[model samples]
Target: MTKLIIQIPCYNEEATLGMTLAELPRQIPGIDQVEWLIVNDGSSDRTVEVALANGVDHVVSFARNQGLAHAFMAGLEACLKAGADIIVNTDADNQYCAADIPRLVEPILQGEADIVVGARPIRQIKHFSPIKKLLQGFGSWVVRLASKTNVVDAPSGFRAISREAALRLNVFNEYTYTLETIIQAGRQGMAIKSVPIRTNGYLRPSRLVKSIPSYVKRSLLTILRISMTYKPLRFFAVLGSIPFSMGFLLGVRWLVLFFLENGTRSRAPSLILAAILILIGFQLWMFGLVADLMAVNRKVLEDIQLRLRRAELNSNQKER
Candidate 1:
Protein backbone atom coordinates (compact mmCIF):
# COMPACT_ATOMS: atom_id res chain seq x y z
CA MET A 1 0.00 0.00 0.00
CA THR A 2 1.24 3.47 -0.83
CA LYS A 3 1.22 5.50 2.37
CA LEU A 4 1.44 9.26 1.86
CA ILE A 5 2.00 11.78 4.63
CA ILE A 6 1.43 15.50 4.16
CA GLN A 7 3.61 17.50 6.57
CA ILE A 8 3.30 21.16 7.52
CA PRO A 9 5.98 23.03 9.43
CA CYS A 10 4.24 25.67 11.48
CA TYR A 11 5.31 28.47 13.77
CA ASN A 12 2.99 30.95 15.54
CA GLU A 13 0.26 30.38 13.00
CA GLU A 14 -2.73 29.67 15.18
CA ALA A 15 -5.08 31.86 13.19
CA THR A 16 -4.25 30.32 9.80
CA LEU A 17 -3.32 26.76 10.74
CA GLY A 18 -6.90 25.57 10.88
CA MET A 19 -7.67 27.01 7.47
CA THR A 20 -4.62 25.33 5.98
CA LEU A 21 -5.44 21.96 7.55
CA ALA A 22 -9.09 22.09 6.65
CA GLU A 23 -8.38 22.04 2.92
CA LEU A 24 -5.87 19.20 2.91
CA PRO A 25 -7.09 16.15 1.02
CA ARG A 26 -7.63 13.05 3.07
CA GLN A 27 -7.53 10.82 0.03
CA ILE A 28 -5.75 10.61 -3.32
CA PRO A 29 -6.24 8.20 -6.12
CA GLY A 30 -2.79 6.53 -6.17
CA ILE A 31 -2.34 6.64 -2.42
CA ASP A 32 -3.87 3.96 -0.26
CA GLN A 33 -3.59 5.98 2.93
CA VAL A 34 -3.08 9.69 3.43
CA GLU A 35 -1.99 11.09 6.81
CA TRP A 36 -1.17 14.51 8.22
CA LEU A 37 1.92 15.43 10.27
CA ILE A 38 2.54 18.83 11.80
CA VAL A 39 5.85 20.13 13.14
CA ASN A 40 5.38 22.74 15.85
CA ASP A 41 8.56 24.75 16.07
CA GLY A 42 8.12 25.85 19.65
CA SER A 43 5.17 28.07 18.98
CA SER A 44 4.05 30.04 22.03
CA ASP A 45 0.56 29.97 20.61
CA ARG A 46 -1.99 27.16 20.30
CA THR A 47 -0.40 25.71 17.17
CA VAL A 48 -0.05 22.31 18.80
CA GLU A 49 -3.62 22.28 20.00
CA VAL A 50 -4.87 23.40 16.61
CA ALA A 51 -2.95 20.60 14.94
CA LEU A 52 -4.35 17.97 17.32
CA ALA A 53 -7.85 19.34 16.90
CA ASN A 54 -7.47 19.16 13.13
CA GLY A 55 -6.95 15.40 13.34
CA VAL A 56 -3.26 15.41 12.63
CA ASP A 57 -1.93 11.87 12.56
CA HIS A 58 1.41 12.90 14.08
CA VAL A 59 2.80 16.10 15.59
CA VAL A 60 6.44 16.88 16.35
CA SER A 61 7.17 19.69 18.77
CA PHE A 62 10.35 21.59 19.49
CA ALA A 63 11.23 23.15 22.83
CA ARG A 64 12.00 26.50 21.20
CA ASN A 65 11.74 28.22 17.86
CA GLN A 66 14.40 26.24 16.04
CA GLY A 67 13.81 27.80 12.59
CA LEU A 68 12.29 26.43 9.40
CA ALA A 69 15.14 24.17 8.34
CA HIS A 70 15.19 22.32 11.64
CA ALA A 71 11.42 22.07 11.73
CA PHE A 72 11.39 20.64 8.21
CA MET A 73 13.99 18.04 9.10
CA ALA A 74 12.07 17.15 12.22
CA GLY A 75 8.88 16.74 10.21
CA LEU A 76 10.66 14.41 7.78
CA GLU A 77 11.80 12.27 10.68
CA ALA A 78 8.31 12.17 12.15
CA CYS A 79 6.81 11.15 8.86
CA LEU A 80 9.37 8.38 8.36
CA LYS A 81 8.76 7.07 11.83
CA ALA A 82 5.04 7.00 11.08
CA GLY A 83 5.72 4.63 8.17
CA ALA A 84 5.16 7.21 5.44
CA ASP A 85 6.06 5.85 2.03
CA ILE A 86 5.90 9.27 0.45
CA ILE A 87 6.09 12.73 2.01
CA VAL A 88 4.49 16.00 0.91
CA ASN A 89 5.64 19.27 2.46
CA THR A 90 3.49 22.40 2.42
CA ASP A 91 3.29 25.75 4.08
CA ALA A 92 1.00 26.32 7.06
CA ASP A 93 -0.14 29.74 5.80
CA ASN A 94 -2.04 28.17 2.91
CA GLN A 95 -0.07 30.03 0.29
CA TYR A 96 -0.26 27.05 -2.00
CA CYS A 97 -3.50 25.44 -3.14
CA ALA A 98 -3.90 22.30 -1.04
CA ALA A 99 -5.84 20.67 -3.86
CA ASP A 100 -2.60 20.45 -5.85
CA ILE A 101 -1.11 17.92 -3.47
CA PRO A 102 -2.12 15.13 -5.77
CA ARG A 103 -0.46 16.85 -8.72
CA LEU A 104 2.74 17.38 -6.76
CA VAL A 105 2.92 13.70 -5.88
CA GLU A 106 2.02 12.43 -9.32
CA PRO A 107 5.59 12.30 -10.64
CA ILE A 108 6.83 10.47 -7.58
CA LEU A 109 3.98 7.97 -7.76
CA GLN A 110 4.71 7.24 -11.40
CA GLY A 111 8.38 6.54 -10.58
CA GLU A 112 9.44 9.36 -12.89
CA ALA A 113 10.91 11.56 -10.20
CA ASP A 114 12.26 11.03 -6.71
CA ILE A 115 11.28 14.56 -5.73
CA VAL A 116 8.61 16.83 -7.25
CA VAL A 117 8.48 20.59 -6.73
CA GLY A 118 5.32 22.59 -7.25
CA ALA A 119 6.38 25.71 -9.14
CA ARG A 120 4.15 28.67 -8.50
CA PRO A 121 3.46 31.19 -11.25
CA ILE A 122 5.64 34.04 -10.13
CA ARG A 123 4.29 36.65 -12.50
CA GLN A 124 0.69 35.81 -11.65
CA ILE A 125 0.99 36.13 -7.88
CA LYS A 126 -0.67 39.49 -7.34
CA HIS A 127 0.77 40.15 -3.91
CA PHE A 128 4.36 39.88 -5.09
CA SER A 129 5.96 43.18 -5.92
CA PRO A 130 7.64 43.53 -9.31
CA ILE A 131 11.04 43.46 -7.65
CA LYS A 132 10.16 40.34 -5.72
CA LYS A 133 9.06 38.54 -8.85
CA LEU A 134 12.24 39.51 -10.68
CA LEU A 135 14.36 38.39 -7.79
CA GLN A 136 12.54 35.14 -7.60
CA GLY A 137 13.13 34.51 -11.28
CA PHE A 138 16.80 35.42 -11.00
CA GLY A 139 17.26 33.21 -7.94
CA SER A 140 15.69 30.27 -9.68
CA TRP A 141 17.98 30.78 -12.66
CA VAL A 142 21.05 30.84 -10.44
CA VAL A 143 19.96 27.65 -8.72
CA ARG A 144 19.46 25.94 -12.04
CA LEU A 145 23.01 26.80 -13.04
CA ALA A 146 24.51 25.85 -9.71
CA SER A 147 22.64 22.59 -9.24
CA LYS A 148 22.79 21.65 -12.93
CA THR A 149 19.09 20.90 -12.77
CA ASN A 150 16.09 22.15 -14.70
CA VAL A 151 14.03 23.11 -11.64
CA VAL A 152 12.26 26.42 -12.29
CA ASP A 153 11.34 27.09 -8.68
CA ALA A 154 14.14 26.70 -6.19
CA PRO A 155 12.44 28.43 -3.26
CA SER A 156 9.13 26.65 -3.51
CA GLY A 157 8.04 24.89 -0.32
CA PHE A 158 5.30 22.79 -1.88
CA ARG A 159 7.06 19.59 -2.83
CA ALA A 160 6.91 15.82 -2.55
CA ILE A 161 9.69 13.36 -1.87
CA SER A 162 9.74 9.61 -1.99
CA ARG A 163 10.89 7.65 1.04
CA GLU A 164 14.22 6.97 -0.66
CA ALA A 165 14.79 10.62 -1.46
CA ALA A 166 13.83 11.78 2.03
CA LEU A 167 16.32 9.43 3.62
CA ARG A 168 19.18 11.05 1.72
CA LEU A 169 18.30 14.71 2.43
CA ASN A 170 20.19 16.73 5.04
CA VAL A 171 19.49 20.38 5.87
CA PHE A 172 22.41 22.42 7.26
CA ASN A 173 20.94 25.89 6.92
CA GLU A 174 18.94 27.50 9.71
CA TYR A 175 17.11 29.87 7.37
CA THR A 176 15.00 27.74 5.04
CA TYR A 177 14.97 24.22 3.58
CA THR A 178 13.55 25.05 0.14
CA LEU A 179 16.77 26.01 -1.65
CA GLU A 180 19.16 23.73 0.17
CA THR A 181 16.97 20.69 -0.38
CA ILE A 182 16.91 21.26 -4.13
CA ILE A 183 20.67 21.70 -4.24
CA GLN A 184 21.12 18.61 -2.09
CA ALA A 185 18.80 16.62 -4.32
CA GLY A 186 20.67 17.74 -7.42
CA ARG A 187 24.10 17.08 -5.94
CA GLN A 188 23.05 13.61 -4.80
CA GLY A 189 21.80 12.83 -8.34
CA MET A 190 18.21 12.36 -7.22
CA ALA A 191 15.60 12.70 -9.92
CA ILE A 192 13.89 16.04 -9.37
CA LYS A 193 11.15 17.60 -11.52
CA SER A 194 9.04 20.74 -11.38
CA VAL A 195 5.39 21.06 -12.36
CA PRO A 196 3.44 24.26 -12.87
CA ILE A 197 0.96 24.87 -10.05
CA ARG A 198 -1.37 27.68 -9.03
CA THR A 199 -1.42 29.38 -5.69
CA ASN A 200 -4.30 30.75 -3.62
CA GLY A 201 -4.87 34.46 -3.05
CA TYR A 202 -2.38 36.07 -0.72
CA LEU A 203 -3.60 35.61 2.83
CA ARG A 204 -0.86 37.65 4.53
CA PRO A 205 2.69 38.77 4.01
CA SER A 206 5.25 35.98 4.24
CA ARG A 207 6.81 35.53 7.65
CA LEU A 208 9.98 34.09 6.17
CA VAL A 209 10.64 36.96 3.83
CA LYS A 210 9.74 39.82 6.09
CA SER A 211 11.49 42.31 3.83
CA ILE A 212 12.82 42.21 0.31
CA PRO A 213 16.42 43.00 1.26
CA SER A 214 16.52 40.38 3.98
CA TYR A 215 14.97 37.78 1.72
CA VAL A 216 17.47 38.42 -1.06
CA LYS A 217 20.41 38.39 1.32
CA ARG A 218 19.42 35.15 3.01
CA SER A 219 18.41 33.43 -0.21
CA LEU A 220 21.62 34.39 -2.03
CA LEU A 221 23.76 33.29 0.90
CA THR A 222 22.03 29.94 1.05
CA ILE A 223 22.46 29.41 -2.69
CA LEU A 224 26.14 30.40 -2.67
CA ARG A 225 26.89 28.24 0.35
CA ILE A 226 25.27 25.22 -1.22
CA SER A 227 27.09 25.87 -4.48
CA MET A 228 30.45 26.07 -2.74
CA THR A 229 29.67 22.98 -0.73
CA TYR A 230 28.59 20.75 -3.59
CA LYS A 231 30.43 22.28 -6.53
CA PRO A 232 33.61 23.55 -4.93
CA LEU A 233 35.60 22.97 -8.08
CA ARG A 234 33.39 25.21 -10.16
CA PHE A 235 33.10 27.85 -7.47
CA PHE A 236 36.83 28.07 -6.85
CA ALA A 237 37.72 27.82 -10.51
CA VAL A 238 35.60 30.84 -11.35
CA LEU A 239 37.00 32.88 -8.48
CA GLY A 240 40.57 31.83 -9.21
CA SER A 241 40.39 32.61 -12.92
CA ILE A 242 39.75 36.31 -12.33
CA PRO A 243 42.96 37.00 -10.40
CA PHE A 244 44.99 34.65 -12.55
CA SER A 245 43.87 36.38 -15.74
CA MET A 246 44.54 39.84 -14.35
CA GLY A 247 47.93 38.81 -12.98
CA PHE A 248 48.99 37.34 -16.31
CA LEU A 249 48.08 40.55 -18.14
CA LEU A 250 49.84 42.70 -15.57
CA GLY A 251 53.00 40.54 -15.65
CA VAL A 252 53.08 40.76 -19.43
CA ARG A 253 52.74 44.55 -19.26
CA TRP A 254 55.61 44.76 -16.76
CA LEU A 255 57.82 42.51 -18.88
CA VAL A 256 57.21 44.55 -22.06
CA LEU A 257 57.86 47.83 -20.24
CA PHE A 258 61.12 46.52 -18.77
CA PHE A 259 62.41 45.27 -22.17
CA LEU A 260 61.47 48.45 -24.02
CA GLU A 261 62.27 51.17 -21.47
CA ASN A 262 64.86 49.35 -19.33
CA GLY A 263 63.23 50.68 -16.17
CA THR A 264 63.98 48.03 -13.56
CA ARG A 265 63.46 50.12 -10.42
CA SER A 266 60.05 51.50 -11.31
CA ARG A 267 58.70 48.13 -12.52
CA ALA A 268 59.86 46.15 -9.47
CA PRO A 269 56.69 46.90 -7.50
CA SER A 270 54.49 46.07 -10.49
CA LEU A 271 56.27 42.76 -11.08
CA ILE A 272 56.05 41.83 -7.40
CA LEU A 273 52.32 42.60 -7.25
CA ALA A 274 51.75 40.60 -10.39
CA ALA A 275 53.62 37.62 -8.97
CA ILE A 276 51.61 37.82 -5.74
CA LEU A 277 48.32 37.83 -7.61
CA ILE A 278 49.47 34.88 -9.68
CA LEU A 279 50.41 32.96 -6.56
CA ILE A 280 47.15 33.82 -4.84
CA GLY A 281 45.18 32.61 -7.82
CA PHE A 282 47.23 29.41 -8.03
CA GLN A 283 46.74 28.75 -4.32
CA LEU A 284 42.98 29.29 -4.66
CA TRP A 285 42.85 26.83 -7.51
CA MET A 286 44.75 24.30 -5.41
CA PHE A 287 42.34 24.88 -2.52
CA GLY A 288 39.47 24.15 -4.87
CA LEU A 289 41.08 20.86 -5.89
CA VAL A 290 41.32 19.83 -2.26
CA ALA A 291 37.72 20.86 -1.59
CA ASP A 292 36.55 18.91 -4.60
CA LEU A 293 38.23 15.81 -3.27
CA MET A 294 36.56 16.30 0.08
CA ALA A 295 33.18 16.76 -1.63
CA VAL A 296 33.63 13.40 -3.33
CA ASN A 297 34.38 11.81 0.00
CA ARG A 298 31.26 13.36 1.47
CA LYS A 299 29.11 11.92 -1.32
CA VAL A 300 30.52 8.47 -0.60
CA LEU A 301 29.78 8.84 3.09
CA GLU A 302 26.25 10.00 2.37
CA ASP A 303 25.62 6.91 0.30
CA ILE A 304 26.75 4.73 3.18
CA GLN A 305 24.56 6.64 5.60
CA LEU A 306 21.49 6.16 3.41
CA ARG A 307 22.13 2.43 3.22
CA LEU A 308 22.45 2.21 6.98
CA ARG A 309 19.19 4.12 7.46
CA ARG A 310 17.36 1.81 5.08
CA ALA A 311 18.63 -1.21 6.92
CA GLU A 312 17.60 0.22 10.26
CA LEU A 313 14.13 1.07 9.04
CA ASN A 314 13.68 -2.41 7.56
CA SER A 315 14.74 -3.98 10.86
CA ASN A 316 12.28 -1.84 12.77
CA GLN A 317 9.48 -2.79 10.41
CA LYS A 318 10.29 -6.46 10.87
CA GLU A 319 10.16 -6.08 14.66
CA ARG A 320 6.85 -4.27 14.51
Candidate 2:
Protein backbone atom coordinates (compact mmCIF):
# COMPACT_ATOMS: atom_id res chain seq x y z
CA MET A 1 0.00 0.00 0.00
CA THR A 2 2.63 2.51 -0.98
CA LYS A 3 0.38 4.97 -2.89
CA LEU A 4 1.86 8.56 -3.00
CA ILE A 5 0.55 10.58 -5.95
CA ILE A 6 1.46 14.30 -5.69
CA GLN A 7 1.29 15.57 -9.26
CA ILE A 8 0.75 19.24 -10.22
CA PRO A 9 1.18 20.54 -13.81
CA CYS A 10 -1.30 23.40 -13.52
CA TYR A 11 -1.83 26.38 -15.81
CA ASN A 12 -3.48 29.76 -15.06
CA GLU A 13 -2.30 28.76 -11.68
CA GLU A 14 -5.07 30.47 -9.78
CA ALA A 15 -2.64 32.73 -8.01
CA THR A 16 0.02 30.22 -7.29
CA LEU A 17 -2.56 27.53 -6.91
CA GLY A 18 -3.54 28.26 -3.36
CA MET A 19 0.02 28.92 -2.34
CA THR A 20 0.85 25.69 -4.02
CA LEU A 21 -1.72 23.73 -2.12
CA ALA A 22 -0.63 25.16 1.16
CA GLU A 23 2.51 23.16 1.40
CA LEU A 24 1.58 19.73 0.26
CA PRO A 25 2.42 16.75 2.35
CA ARG A 26 -0.58 14.95 3.56
CA GLN A 27 1.99 12.74 5.12
CA ILE A 28 5.08 10.93 4.01
CA PRO A 29 7.35 8.39 5.46
CA GLY A 30 7.29 5.18 3.59
CA ILE A 31 4.05 6.68 2.32
CA ASP A 32 1.06 4.51 2.93
CA GLN A 33 -1.16 6.96 1.06
CA VAL A 34 -0.41 10.61 0.29
CA GLU A 35 -2.42 11.88 -2.60
CA TRP A 36 -3.03 15.16 -4.48
CA LEU A 37 -3.09 15.51 -8.25
CA ILE A 38 -3.87 18.53 -10.45
CA VAL A 39 -3.22 18.55 -14.22
CA ASN A 40 -6.10 20.97 -15.00
CA ASP A 41 -3.99 22.33 -17.83
CA GLY A 42 -6.61 24.47 -19.42
CA SER A 43 -7.34 26.56 -16.39
CA SER A 44 -9.09 29.74 -17.28
CA ASP A 45 -9.09 30.54 -13.64
CA ARG A 46 -9.98 28.97 -10.33
CA THR A 47 -7.52 26.30 -11.39
CA VAL A 48 -10.11 23.66 -10.82
CA GLU A 49 -11.50 25.68 -7.95
CA VAL A 50 -8.03 26.13 -6.60
CA ALA A 51 -7.46 22.47 -6.89
CA LEU A 52 -10.62 21.70 -5.02
CA ALA A 53 -9.96 24.19 -2.28
CA ASN A 54 -6.53 22.82 -1.74
CA GLY A 55 -7.25 19.26 -0.82
CA VAL A 56 -6.86 18.01 -4.36
CA ASP A 57 -7.17 14.29 -4.72
CA HIS A 58 -7.28 14.21 -8.51
CA VAL A 59 -8.33 16.49 -11.37
CA VAL A 60 -6.68 15.95 -14.76
CA SER A 61 -9.06 18.19 -16.69
CA PHE A 62 -7.76 19.84 -19.88
CA ALA A 63 -9.95 21.63 -22.27
CA ARG A 64 -7.17 23.64 -23.86
CA ASN A 65 -3.75 24.59 -22.55
CA GLN A 66 -2.39 21.14 -23.27
CA GLY A 67 1.31 21.87 -22.96
CA LEU A 68 3.71 20.89 -20.28
CA ALA A 69 4.25 17.71 -22.18
CA HIS A 70 0.50 17.19 -22.22
CA ALA A 71 0.22 18.17 -18.62
CA PHE A 72 2.91 15.72 -17.78
CA MET A 73 1.31 12.85 -19.51
CA ALA A 74 -2.01 13.87 -18.02
CA GLY A 75 -0.57 13.68 -14.59
CA LEU A 76 0.79 10.32 -15.45
CA GLU A 77 -2.58 9.05 -16.49
CA ALA A 78 -4.16 10.38 -13.33
CA CYS A 79 -1.52 8.81 -11.20
CA LEU A 80 -1.72 5.54 -12.98
CA LYS A 81 -5.50 5.35 -12.69
CA ALA A 82 -5.45 6.41 -9.06
CA GLY A 83 -3.48 3.55 -7.72
CA ALA A 84 -0.17 5.38 -7.63
CA ASP A 85 2.57 3.28 -6.21
CA ILE A 86 4.76 6.39 -6.36
CA ILE A 87 4.79 9.37 -8.74
CA VAL A 88 5.65 12.78 -7.47
CA ASN A 89 5.96 15.49 -10.10
CA THR A 90 5.88 18.73 -8.11
CA ASP A 91 5.68 22.36 -9.31
CA ALA A 92 2.60 24.45 -9.85
CA ASP A 93 4.72 27.51 -9.05
CA ASN A 94 5.98 26.65 -5.61
CA GLN A 95 9.34 25.88 -7.10
CA TYR A 96 9.94 22.77 -5.10
CA CYS A 97 10.72 22.37 -1.38
CA ALA A 98 7.57 20.81 -0.12
CA ALA A 99 9.85 19.79 2.69
CA ASP A 100 12.10 18.21 0.13
CA ILE A 101 9.41 15.69 -0.69
CA PRO A 102 10.92 13.24 1.68
CA ARG A 103 14.23 13.88 0.00
CA LEU A 104 12.50 13.17 -3.27
CA VAL A 105 10.98 9.89 -2.38
CA GLU A 106 14.12 8.63 -0.70
CA PRO A 107 15.66 6.82 -3.67
CA ILE A 108 12.35 5.22 -4.41
CA LEU A 109 11.83 4.17 -0.81
CA GLN A 110 15.33 2.80 -0.62
CA GLY A 111 14.96 0.10 -3.18
CA GLU A 112 17.65 2.33 -4.69
CA ALA A 113 15.90 4.26 -7.49
CA ASP A 114 13.64 4.03 -10.45
CA ILE A 115 13.59 7.73 -11.15
CA VAL A 116 14.37 10.27 -8.43
CA VAL A 117 15.73 13.54 -9.92
CA GLY A 118 15.28 16.58 -7.63
CA ALA A 119 18.74 18.08 -7.93
CA ARG A 120 18.18 21.83 -8.18
CA PRO A 121 21.27 23.59 -6.96
CA ILE A 122 22.26 25.36 -10.11
CA ARG A 123 24.97 27.39 -8.49
CA GLN A 124 22.74 28.20 -5.51
CA ILE A 125 19.78 29.36 -7.59
CA LYS A 126 19.14 32.99 -6.68
CA HIS A 127 16.80 33.61 -9.56
CA PHE A 128 19.37 32.07 -11.78
CA SER A 129 20.59 34.26 -14.68
CA PRO A 130 24.25 33.83 -14.93
CA ILE A 131 22.97 33.03 -18.36
CA LYS A 132 20.42 31.00 -16.43
CA LYS A 133 23.22 29.35 -14.62
CA LEU A 134 25.04 28.66 -17.79
CA LEU A 135 21.96 27.22 -19.28
CA GLN A 136 21.45 24.97 -16.34
CA GLY A 137 24.97 23.69 -16.49
CA PHE A 138 24.94 23.32 -20.19
CA GLY A 139 21.54 21.74 -20.03
CA SER A 140 22.67 19.20 -17.54
CA TRP A 141 25.63 18.42 -19.71
CA VAL A 142 23.49 17.77 -22.71
CA VAL A 143 21.29 15.48 -20.63
CA ARG A 144 24.29 13.59 -19.40
CA LEU A 145 25.37 13.09 -22.97
CA ALA A 146 21.99 12.30 -24.41
CA SER A 147 20.95 10.25 -21.43
CA LYS A 148 23.62 7.77 -20.75
CA THR A 149 22.33 9.04 -17.35
CA ASN A 150 24.06 10.79 -14.55
CA VAL A 151 21.08 13.11 -14.30
CA VAL A 152 22.10 16.19 -12.37
CA ASP A 153 18.67 17.67 -12.82
CA ALA A 154 17.84 17.73 -16.46
CA PRO A 155 15.44 20.66 -16.07
CA SER A 156 14.05 19.02 -13.00
CA GLY A 157 10.36 19.36 -12.39
CA PHE A 158 11.14 17.75 -9.10
CA ARG A 159 10.88 14.09 -9.81
CA ALA A 160 10.10 10.63 -8.51
CA ILE A 161 8.33 8.09 -10.68
CA SER A 162 8.23 4.44 -10.18
CA ARG A 163 5.00 2.52 -10.87
CA GLU A 164 7.52 0.81 -12.97
CA ALA A 165 8.68 4.24 -14.06
CA ALA A 166 5.11 5.14 -14.74
CA LEU A 167 4.67 2.32 -17.16
CA ARG A 168 7.61 3.41 -19.23
CA LEU A 169 6.90 7.10 -19.77
CA ASN A 170 6.36 8.54 -23.25
CA VAL A 171 5.98 12.36 -23.14
CA PHE A 172 6.38 13.43 -26.75
CA ASN A 173 7.16 16.99 -25.66
CA GLU A 174 4.78 19.82 -26.26
CA TYR A 175 7.57 21.92 -24.82
CA THR A 176 8.44 20.65 -21.42
CA TYR A 177 7.95 17.57 -19.38
CA THR A 178 11.05 18.74 -17.64
CA LEU A 179 13.41 17.90 -20.46
CA GLU A 180 11.45 15.16 -22.01
CA THR A 181 11.00 13.27 -18.78
CA ILE A 182 14.73 13.27 -18.12
CA ILE A 183 15.50 12.02 -21.55
CA GLN A 184 12.71 9.51 -21.19
CA ALA A 185 13.86 8.21 -17.85
CA GLY A 186 17.44 8.22 -18.99
CA ARG A 187 17.12 6.24 -22.16
CA GLN A 188 14.69 3.81 -20.55
CA GLY A 189 17.19 1.96 -18.46
CA MET A 190 15.40 3.46 -15.46
CA ALA A 191 17.18 3.44 -12.06
CA ILE A 192 17.71 7.20 -12.30
CA LYS A 193 18.74 9.04 -9.13
CA SER A 194 19.70 12.60 -8.10
CA VAL A 195 18.38 13.71 -4.63
CA PRO A 196 19.85 17.00 -3.23
CA ILE A 197 16.67 19.01 -3.52
CA ARG A 198 15.24 22.10 -1.75
CA THR A 199 14.04 25.41 -3.08
CA ASN A 200 11.13 27.82 -2.73
CA GLY A 201 11.64 31.53 -2.95
CA TYR A 202 11.08 32.46 -6.54
CA LEU A 203 7.33 32.61 -6.73
CA ARG A 204 7.29 33.55 -10.41
CA PRO A 205 9.31 34.19 -13.57
CA SER A 206 9.42 30.90 -15.38
CA ARG A 207 6.60 29.97 -17.59
CA LEU A 208 9.15 27.47 -18.69
CA VAL A 209 11.97 29.90 -19.29
CA LYS A 210 10.19 32.56 -21.29
CA SER A 211 13.40 33.42 -23.06
CA ILE A 212 17.05 32.56 -22.80
CA PRO A 213 17.60 32.12 -26.45
CA SER A 214 14.11 30.72 -26.32
CA TYR A 215 15.12 28.41 -23.56
CA VAL A 216 18.22 27.25 -25.29
CA LYS A 217 16.32 26.75 -28.47
CA ARG A 218 13.58 24.74 -26.86
CA SER A 219 16.02 22.81 -24.76
CA LEU A 220 18.14 21.83 -27.69
CA LEU A 221 15.13 20.75 -29.67
CA THR A 222 14.00 18.67 -26.74
CA ILE A 223 17.38 17.05 -26.54
CA LEU A 224 17.58 16.59 -30.25
CA ARG A 225 14.14 15.13 -30.40
CA ILE A 226 14.76 12.73 -27.56
CA SER A 227 18.13 11.83 -29.01
CA MET A 228 16.56 10.87 -32.26
CA THR A 229 13.84 9.06 -30.39
CA TYR A 230 16.04 7.04 -28.09
CA LYS A 231 19.31 6.69 -29.92
CA PRO A 232 18.43 5.91 -33.47
CA LEU A 233 21.65 4.09 -34.14
CA ARG A 234 23.64 6.32 -31.85
CA PHE A 235 21.78 9.31 -33.17
CA PHE A 236 22.50 8.54 -36.77
CA ALA A 237 25.91 7.21 -36.05
CA VAL A 238 26.89 10.39 -34.22
CA LEU A 239 25.21 12.28 -37.02
CA GLY A 240 27.03 10.36 -39.68
CA SER A 241 30.35 10.94 -38.03
CA ILE A 242 30.38 14.61 -38.95
CA PRO A 243 30.15 14.22 -42.68
CA PHE A 244 31.93 10.93 -42.29
CA SER A 245 34.99 12.58 -40.83
CA MET A 246 34.79 15.35 -43.39
CA GLY A 247 34.74 12.87 -46.19
CA PHE A 248 37.70 11.00 -44.86
CA LEU A 249 39.84 14.10 -44.63
CA LEU A 250 38.82 15.03 -48.12
CA GLY A 251 39.74 11.69 -49.58
CA VAL A 252 43.13 11.91 -47.93
CA ARG A 253 43.65 15.32 -49.41
CA TRP A 254 42.93 14.04 -52.85
CA LEU A 255 45.39 11.24 -52.50
CA VAL A 256 48.28 13.42 -51.44
CA LEU A 257 47.73 15.72 -54.42
CA PHE A 258 47.72 12.68 -56.74
CA PHE A 259 50.97 11.11 -55.65
CA LEU A 260 52.74 14.48 -55.75
CA GLU A 261 51.44 15.45 -59.19
CA ASN A 262 52.59 12.42 -61.14
CA GLY A 263 49.22 12.44 -62.94
CA THR A 264 45.51 13.45 -62.82
CA ARG A 265 44.42 16.92 -63.91
CA SER A 266 44.51 19.19 -60.85
CA ARG A 267 43.11 16.41 -58.61
CA ALA A 268 39.87 16.38 -60.65
CA PRO A 269 38.20 19.05 -58.59
CA SER A 270 39.67 17.53 -55.47
CA LEU A 271 38.39 14.11 -56.39
CA ILE A 272 34.93 15.46 -57.18
CA LEU A 273 34.65 17.22 -53.85
CA ALA A 274 35.84 14.08 -52.17
CA ALA A 275 33.22 12.02 -53.93
CA ILE A 276 30.44 14.32 -52.84
CA LEU A 277 31.33 14.24 -49.20
CA ILE A 278 31.76 10.50 -49.31
CA LEU A 279 28.27 10.01 -50.69
CA ILE A 280 26.87 12.42 -48.15
CA GLY A 281 28.53 10.45 -45.44
CA PHE A 282 27.33 7.22 -46.88
CA GLN A 283 23.81 8.56 -47.07
CA LEU A 284 23.97 9.58 -43.44
CA TRP A 285 25.16 6.18 -42.45
CA MET A 286 22.33 4.68 -44.43
CA PHE A 287 19.95 6.78 -42.39
CA GLY A 288 21.39 5.18 -39.34
CA LEU A 289 20.73 1.76 -40.66
CA VAL A 290 17.11 2.55 -41.37
CA ALA A 291 16.79 4.43 -38.10
CA ASP A 292 18.09 1.43 -36.30
CA LEU A 293 15.30 -0.70 -37.59
CA MET A 294 12.78 1.89 -36.58
CA ALA A 295 14.32 1.92 -33.14
CA VAL A 296 13.81 -1.78 -32.90
CA ASN A 297 10.24 -1.35 -33.93
CA ARG A 298 9.91 1.26 -31.26
CA LYS A 299 11.07 -1.12 -28.65
CA VAL A 300 8.53 -3.61 -29.78
CA LEU A 301 5.79 -1.03 -29.59
CA GLU A 302 7.00 -0.15 -26.15
CA ASP A 303 6.71 -3.68 -25.04
CA ILE A 304 3.18 -3.83 -26.28
CA GLN A 305 2.53 -0.58 -24.51
CA LEU A 306 3.80 -1.97 -21.28
CA ARG A 307 1.67 -4.98 -21.51
CA LEU A 308 -1.35 -2.98 -22.48
CA ARG A 309 -0.70 -0.66 -19.60
CA ARG A 310 -0.55 -3.42 -17.11
CA ALA A 311 -3.49 -5.25 -18.54
CA GLU A 312 -5.52 -2.12 -18.74
CA LEU A 313 -4.75 -0.96 -15.24
CA ASN A 314 -5.16 -4.35 -13.76
CA SER A 315 -8.47 -4.71 -15.50
CA ASN A 316 -9.67 -1.42 -14.14
CA GLN A 317 -8.66 -2.35 -10.63
CA LYS A 318 -10.63 -5.51 -10.92
CA GLU A 319 -13.58 -3.45 -12.07
CA ARG A 320 -13.68 -1.35 -8.96
User: Which tens-of-lDDT digit does each residue in 78-197 have in candidate 2?
Assistant: 799888989988888898888899888888898899888898888988878788898788889888888888888788888888898888888887888787777777777788888898
Runs with alpha carbons beyond 4 Å of true place in candidate 2: 1-4, 7-22, 25-87, 90-124, 127-132, 135-137, 140-154, 159-165, 168-182, 185-198, 201-234, 241-245, 264-287, 310-316
Model 1 Cα lDDT, one tens digit per residue, 84-132: 9999999999999999999999999899999999999999888888999
Q: Which prediction has the highest lDDT against the true structure?
A: 1
Pairs of colliding residues, candidate 2: none
Instruction: Rate residue 115 of model 2 by lDDT.
Output: 86
Candidate number achieving the greatest TM-score relative to the actual structure: 1
